[model samples]
Target: MLTKSSQSVATIKAEDASKNCILVFDPDKTHAGKLNAILDFLGYDLLLAHSREELAHQLKKYPGLLTIIITGDLSETEQQDIVNIVAREAEHILPVVLYSVPAKNEQPVSLRYPPSWVAVKYPIAHQEFSSALDRVHAHFAHQQTEKGQRPAHLFRSLIGRSPAMQHIRHEIEQVGPTDATVLILGESGTGKEVVARNLHYHSRRRGKAFVPVNCGAIPRDLLESELFGHEKGAFTGALTAREGRFSLASGGTLFLDEIGEMPMDMQVKLLRVLEERTFERVGGSKTIKADVRIVAATNCNLEQMVADGTFREDLFYRLEVFPINLPPLRERVEDLPLLIAQLNDRMEYEKHFSVRFSPDAVSILSGYSWPGNVRELANLIERLGIKFPNGLVEVNDLPMKYRSGTGDGVSHDSQLDFFAEAAAAVRSQPFAVKTKPTVAQILANGQDMKSYVSEVEKNLISQALEETDGVIAHAAKLLGLRRTTLTEKMRKYGLQRPREGRATG
Candidate 1:
């Protein structure tokens, strides 16, 4: 009977020992002992580390550690140092929980730290700590699932691992092999063309040409001839017979970019060709069969256009068979680091120059609205590569407006006024004017000349800043203004760098 009782006790102790352990680091030995006692009573194994070296040793010793809890006595710098060390030494990224006593004027702990890092106040109740720990565990599990769900490669050109991107990849996989008409919708610079190419590359027509035409860029009169070949002497400038996009893209894919910009008349013709799979060249009687897949993309809302009577309802339905909407850069901020890395790689390959962005620089970028989206990011990366050329991009290297998270610093009222004036100018001008309107003529039109001029000045400054990747001195030089004068204007316009006390260099 005694032997059986001893075995039962040993088995209970062994089971208790098998529970997951948490590593705690506290400078105050008494406080540490108190925490250990509390945790022990709650059936958790605890490992205490009093110094940096001891913490490192404990991390290795407890490979199956559930989490790390740090007490509030450490300064911000010390906390950062500990985090850095943890990041470097850990076999994998670990969830970190910080316990700090808030100052009288300090913001809430939740607001001060990101969601990925749990922050709790000192004198934490057992139940509160347990709840926080449960949340941390759930977050870590979700991260692991997300990591597993990521496809090895979505496409050669597209790069992202967020859930949004994963959905897009799944859509592409389902739709790529089919000959269905696809409509890609997104804002400008959101990689619509890249998506189209991926679909084409994966389709049955991969061996054939992938032709892309920008309907909005070509004149309406020439668009018809561009889509369908024009015969010799078909028009005043037709010197010889030339094939259109349809013939060039036969047995392949035809990408209609900015398709919403197609005129109403052209939409009818396009609908007819799509329905019949046949079209005739301009001034030619031959009916050419179009053995091509259609992939249309537009930044404008086709449904809205149809409702507005600008786009044909039938054509919209035909193209909307398979729709894919790309999330904007701002929507997928988690992909910024990956994007930055890819852009750096591309810069190195194409320009033979590269630059690395500091973590703070990336953090600042991730907070911006990214109005121009991925294209804007790519442009900025290229500019950075040119400027730094194998240098590190610190937060101060970012433009004042970007650093400040205020894009171009244009007031909402001013922006509205600028657009209003531009629309009015367009409405008043003749569609087929023989010559450009002079500055005086433009001012004579119903526009506040001063505001219009100021808008133009602001636009110029914004463009210069964008071109220089927010470098003040470079922008000032491009504008032929003294650096101080440019700085004054930036201030006057409410443009400020992301952070103060950082050099504008």
Candidate 2:
């Protein structure tokens, strides 16, 4: 539906998009349309700084901002605002601000650009500026890349109608175009890996490989070689040189699932690769460029793991740039019908047979708790298809556990009608009131880091114990801690329930 003015847009160098990204600030609305189309056609990462605040924010957010286009006959006030923001926040790293002009000699006046910035008349930039533009190849050489390819047939779209699913799709679409690291979080069978694949499918790296590595599945001793590859005779099993997930996923995406399961020493090496964007294979001195985008997923309580000294804090912050938390099926029961349809469709396509869930059967399934999440639902659908073939599944046909739900399945006590309204809540919002001090407040107060952390941990354990009525196992689960660990922390802090005392805790 988009019509290009000329093929000249395509004639530009293919790699220019990454290095020649532009930010347009056209307060007058004069040059937005033409430039918008040109940038789109040319595959440039175009962004708009509609307000002065946005100009500063975008500069710090996207290091790939190579060029800036500011339009309108700049009044003295507007020019000063632009100069102050761009100079302060943008770092003026090869800053080349092009001002839209009416004629060649007529300068867009009064905009006394900073000494570090190069201001040029637009629609006719100086020829020498092209050389300066060429230097932009290094713009994101140290930052990130957005080289992606989208192919339709390779993956299934996320299927759901819940608010949680809608938010997830929005996030995927927003960050999919850029090369930011994504961390998917959820319980087992909640489809963490599926989210990773969806991210890759929607990303610019769709044409590249989507290499997945389950850190927990691989032995700790071999995880390093599995990720960074190995040279011939690297170890006992290294009979020949082999490419690892990082090498295999070059110019693509490396999905590190169960990242929490990665050992501590290996975590150090992985951190180096991520920070340096270069890694040498095991037993090899040759350093290779890591052109792969990282997408990590883990069901483990990484925050709790970090608190317990099990996971790396720095590595946690690194991969957790943009986190996508998947809602478990029990929390989003309204999405069951849509998820069922998707799974049934898959079964029919693959096996040439299907089973349809009647309305009552769906209601029963919704009322029943799903401990295994979507993967459980998927397995159930496949089993039903095999049992009933092309037949309809009625309420009686469902498992006893589902049929045993509140009477007619949909009807329940007014106080406990979970199936009717559970999905309305966003997964990330905690039901309990959070009255803890923010990271900013803690940092600004200049408190001792160790003492502050211990006090906070003590407070959390106390709160959890209070909420669970001094039940140790229950409170431990609520705080995502091991029962033994929580008990030890309780002893360390001398946490005890009133009247019941330490023995109860």
Candidate 3:
């Protein structure tokens, strides 16, 4: 039994606990394990509640845990107990997804359910599981955002918690207010455009439009007309007068992507516009005021281009006023978990689909150079959602370039329980005994303290070794045990590190 909270019931902040903390209860451990595997891979924090008391305790402890999943058959008494406990949680209301076998031909809807509870038939399909998650996510996003309870600048589109991401976000806030010519530098697919949009959203002109034009994508001959608009009969294809990117941006932002690829003639013209804030329409003498903030982005070396006499020096200096450099994905590998979580959330919320990458799979991805940057990572996430839709993606599941480690051409599918699976996946915790074994479940089964502690120790050491691919130093670091101590423990337990291609407990 757990000690109960004596603190008076009071209002709780939704952001009190970490986001996406899901608490689940199921009498059938196997079903719970399956959910654990799915939820962990999908990038959620899963906490198993052993009893009604434990469930209530966790809800009160983690107010950010807004979603509760209760599975298996609940007796009328047990159901009432859970309802009362949840109702007592006055601080934050929690949504419940209940899975129960329908007696005879009775439908799930025919049964009585508590407030904030929805029932799924006994045999829950992948689709229903995803739908349940969507409902909870939608409720949280819509309600919290509508009430203004959530921060205005949470910036779901710009996902990261790493220091690098924090610095970038801070930079956006600092430079977003200025009207200076901004140059965004990053490798292709590193989200230069995404940063530009963030700049626009935070600017005073957010209410206005944000126009993006790929300067390199447009033809060299027509680039002038595209930037400054053209009068009717200006060119062979110009049938009528039209607003160019400058006119369309009209007091907002003009994001010039691949600006390095602009012809030298256009660079000279662009520099004049930057210096004078005015440009004449092609084949028209009218000088239109360029009421737009210039935001140019490119993966090329503009400085080198200037030295090579390909790009104009004046234009290079003009666009370099406020440079924002985006670091490549490989440099900030720590942000992978958050990025994957955000991507998975997008897929689930939009398509009613969800998937997860095994800890080993994520570890393997971390080792890659990520030449394509975040775009490549996003594409891979989408591909996994399509390929293994609504399931787990193990190391072997990844494409050839990403495949490595002991998982190569190997399968450990039927080996460990979901408990070990999650602990291995977590980078923060080398081993997390999410829910400690209760005295009743252990002592009542004729277990003693000495044996229990040793057993638990052996299991954790085994799991850490397996997760680190039987590497002694790595496993020791994960277990927080010195190499000598871990080796001694292995000897005491009659255990030995498995071979490179295979691991066992």
Candidate 4:
């Protein structure tokens, strides 16, 4: 039991007791005592709940009054469940502080929010705890001014355990609190949207709306009006005065995904919005003040686009106030198992078959380069779940591409050599090695691009014919080129198929 101090460290004289109370939930009594001591020292009164059930009960009676401080060890799953529960039950304005202490000599970061509500490890000093509560209190006071509504969808506590994901989470934590416009750079399937959401949820304006617009998905003609709003009679299908995403998300965030695809003309207008924080609706003269944080994401290289003059340079700089680059899936292959487990749980919940990959299957997956990043891996796992309905996916249960030795990440020369050796050892075939120049070397040597490419193509075809006992189709597959393309290149290069004379040589 925590002994309360005689005098309050902080005081809020609320006529309604329910409107000004704090709730602290701790599974560990020791940590809970530390928190209580800090609150007592700060002159703030708090209600304590030792279990989830008890916390849920208090949340029901005084949904508006409660802000939460949760600490101690809990699993990732439990943390996420509580977040979902809080989102479901609490008043939109309520804030929750998730604090934790790591085990002795252990790092205390939780990957996903499920097992622990919102985690802060131990060794947190009294001032740190007090400052955290003060921030939360300020946020709730702002919520009260704004009508007891918090940005519900935006405050999601994203959870993941992979190192790549951990790095991303840290980046979000560092960047989210500020008003800086962030540019999230990642491949198509790398969950840029999730990062955007996390940024908005953790920002000062977290209680406001977070509107996400996919730039690539929307029609180019409509994107401008969609973002800036249109008047009642702006154009066809303009039924009434409509607010744009910028207006709807006023005092919050507007996430522009696939921003690389935005038109050059619109980019200029967007630049103005960022600069002036104001925009006029189509067919309307009134300049509305924009009060939204902008977070943009792109898979394309904006610098290249700037050099080409297809994208506005001014807009690029404005949008890139802060930038985060997500590592590709292949670069973070170590995270494959954890991602697979997450996918498995998600699929099971969706009534997709509960599937488990065998150790060999997992090994094969981890070894392969995920060109499509996390999205592709997720699709592959979901597919496996269905293909192996019984949940146990064996080595053979994988696709042929996965089973093949093509995932070795070997050089082209090594691959060709391996094939040549296998043919020579198994079938008494003679092997011929091709001397080829790399594209870079050819360019550096001042050879014409067309000629250089043709020379390389000829060498590959000649080598394929030499290695396959002049078998064109098999050699085509070995080189990962179509039979017709190989044949055409051979003719173009004036290289003949190995006939009787060539075979003898």
Q: Stretches of candidate 2 above 4 Å error?
A: 1-154, 406-505
Best by TM-score: 3
The model with the greatest lDDT is 3
Candidate 1 residue spans exceeding 4 A from truth: 1-156, 406-505
Q: Evaluate candidate 2 by giving its C-alpha RMSD to the native, one decimal.
A: 19.8
Could you tally the backbone clashes for each prediction? 5, 4, 1, 22
Local accuracy of candidate 2 as per-residue lDDT tens digits, 320-407: 9999999877656656766775576556545656676654466568665576888888888888888887666777888776677532
**TM-score attained by model 2:** 0.53
- Could you tell which candidate, 2 or 4, scores higher by TM-score? 2
Quote the RMSD, in angstroms, for model 3: 11.9
What overall lDDT, based on C-alpha atoms, would model 2 receive against the true structure? 0.67
Q: Any residue pairs clashing in model 2, and if so which?
A: 148-204, 148-205, 149-204, 149-206
**lDDT by residue for model 1 (1-505), tens:** 1011012322333222211456677777756655654443233456677777777766555454556777747766666777776776753535555465568998644333334666665655433554565554444444444667421122346776556787898899899999999999999999999999999978989999999999999999999999998999988999999999999999999999999999999999999998999999899998999889999999999999999999999999999999999988765665676677556555554465667665456666765667899999989988887888766677799977667744543222222233233222122232222354432234444443344546565777777777777788887777655588678768757776534554475
Give the TM-scores of the predictions, in the order they appear: 0.52, 0.53, 0.61, 0.52
Q: Which candidate model has the greater lDDT, 2 or 4? A: 2
Clash pairs, candidate 3, are 41-356
Clashing pairs for model 1 are 400-496, 400-497, 403-498, 404-497, 404-498
lDDT of 4 at 303: 95
